[model samples]
Target: MPLTFRKSFQILPGVRLNINKRSWSITTGGKNGPRHTHSSTGRRTTSMDLPGPFGWRKTRKGGGH
Candidate 1:
């Protein structure tokens, strides 16, 4: 298997900091609510769960080359 590294720290309620081999990100939200993530690599992600086995997600890149 390929080497991998990832860790997460809870900064506050509904907030966390995630670190990986390539980048770091901040996540905010609860499991039942909409969540958002902003990465050091200039990528942003938003996700939310539905009533059933469904979910919603969106991704938007930052102003970077």
Candidate 2:
């Protein structure tokens, strides 16, 4: 089955924060998803979800944090 656990947050006028099972990314553009400034994946631990800016955190495994 397909994973539909994606969540998005607007950080600015045309910038967004995207969180999914695979990665957490910052997308910048209009209407559609981000087309720039995508970061590489990293291993995430339990402490990564302590609330703050998720953009500064590492990517987690499984179905998001």
Candidate 3:
């Protein structure tokens, strides 16, 4: 959906909004479809477990909280 905005001032705690509606259609790919993929040798090289929320910092600095 597309929307447009207009300028206006508020006095006593008021809110303003703009709304727009749109029509959607599917193309040749169809609505929600998965893409193609290549197969792997099943080496299991990656780790499935990691420190929860702060995983990003651990990659750069070398430790987890």
Candidate 4:
């Protein structure tokens, strides 16, 4: 498998957001076994995905996420 790089931001003490800048794909028996492409549309993740102090809450412009 290929490795992925990401940048993360901490909105709160235990809350975080992640951003990825690339897309990845894998193929078997192809000229290129794996391929990675740079993308402008990135992915995002938040601490709300896990069971923790964070929940489905609205965030203000300069507040939580």
Per-candidate RMSD, Å: 2.3, 12.6, 20.6, 16.6
Among these predictions, the greatest TM-score belongs to 1
Query: TM-score for every candidate vs. truth?
Result: 0.86, 0.46, 0.13, 0.26
Question: How many Å off is the CA of 37 in candidate 2?
Answer: 4.6
Report how far off residue 51 is in candidate 4 (Å): 19
For model 4, the run of ten residues with the poorest summed lDDT:
26-35
Question: Residue 7 CA error for candidate 1 (Å)?
Answer: 0.4
Which residue pairs show collisions in model 1? none
Overlapping backbone residue pairs in candidate 3 total: 0
Q: Write the number of the candidate with greater lDDT, choosing between 1 and 3.
A: 1
Off by over 4 Å in 3: 1-20, 29-65
Candidate-wise lDDT, in order: 0.93, 0.56, 0.23, 0.34
lDDT of 2 by residue, 13-59 (tens): 87778888777877666633324435336333322223455433333
Best by lDDT: 1
Ranking of all predicted structures according to lDDT, beginning with the best and ending with the worst: 1, 2, 4, 3
Q: Candidates sorted by TM-score, descending order?
A: 1, 2, 4, 3
Give the residue spans of candidate 2 off by over 4 A.
Answer: 31-34, 42-65
Clashes of 2: 0
| Better candidate by TM-score, 1 or 3 | 1
Q: Which window of ten consecutive residues has the lowest lDDT sum in model 2? A: 42-51
